[model samples]
Target: MMVNDPNLFWFGCVLWLVIIWLIVSLRHSNKVDSPTESNTAGAREIEELRQECLRLREELQMQSKQLKTDFQNATFSQLQTLLNNYPSVRKMTEAKPDLPAKNLVSLFTSLDNLLASWGYEQIGSAWEQVPYNPQLHQPDTNDIAEGELVYIRFVGYREGSRILSPAKVSRTLPISSPSK
Candidate 1:
């Protein structure tokens, strides 16, 4: 129209250049910031992984403690009868200030029950005079050789094929005599 308006044509060219420059600059800024964005994402992921590891460790510790408690319960629960009578034993002693030896039968019975519950067998009766087998008897003196007659002071205990405690043996029997 009217000689194409030379001033308007120059203005249009400048505006187009500005628009192109803005587009290129915006794309360059985004490209430059891309690595920083990725680094931030990587840091966040690492923190999340650390948190998960801590959670797993805590869970494992809890399970270990629980298993320990369960094992202890299982081990002690074998002597349920003895545990049940333990309180009564204390009360019996308290009730009788002058408690005689024979009145302590309850205590002995509890001990026997405890040993039986653990699958143990008594090696010898108290004051039992038997020919010594070194495997089953522990003599008071080293001079007392095997196959000699010895008396049991306190009965020993054994489990299946394994000896827990060998019978305590002496050369002479006690005055109380053997109580089979």
Candidate 2:
């Protein structure tokens, strides 16, 4: 019985050593795994931040493009308003007849230059006579013949295929001769 007791004591010591080794190994492994998990979480957060930044940049670019388009439209609207007012001034000058021809020419030339810069162009010339066509001219009165055209009252303007304004014109009728 004494010899069996010594054997049992050594067996118990070996078993305790194995249990302590296992516990230490498990703790070391847990420490290693915790750092890896934290690193993965950090990488995920960084990726999310990057995606957010890209989305913000795209939004900013879209906003800038919209602003540019709005500014261009506003500028075009102002130019159209200025062009619309020119015909009244031109008519007033014509009525006076005392205004110098050179002054009128200069004013028209400058206006033409401004229009050309903005992709707009005058469609007709003053005193131009052409065969009457309903598509290009608007008649002021219906008293004259249909086929004839006299001096234009106001010139037309166009941009691309769009007509900004139509020409105002009068038609001339041939005078009837007395019976032979």
Model 2 stretches astray by more than 4 angstroms: 1-108, 143-147, 172-180
lDDT of 1 by residue, 73-155 (tens): 56555744444344334444444546663366555676667567667677776656798988888888898978888977666
The per-residue C-alpha lDDT of model 2 at residue 79 equals 67
TM-score of 1: 0.44
Please, what is the whole-model Cα lDDT of each candidate in the order they appear? Answer: 0.64, 0.60
Tens-digit lDDT string for candidate 2 (1-180): 454544346655765665576556556665776877756655665566567656755765687678765774566566655564456445545555566642654566676676677677665654456666566667777664557766465667677777767666766412321122
Question: What local lDDT does model 2 show for residue 119?
Answer: 77
TM-score of each model, in listed order: 0.44, 0.44
Instruction: Kindly report which residue pairs in candidate 1 clash with one another.
Output: none
- The positional error of residue 102 in candidate 1, measured at the CA in angstroms, is 0.6
Candidate 2 whole-model C-alpha lDDT, 0 to 1: 0.60
How many angstroms is residue 122 displaced in model 1 relative to the true structure, after the best TM-score fit? 0.6
Residue 171 error for model 1, in Å?
1.4
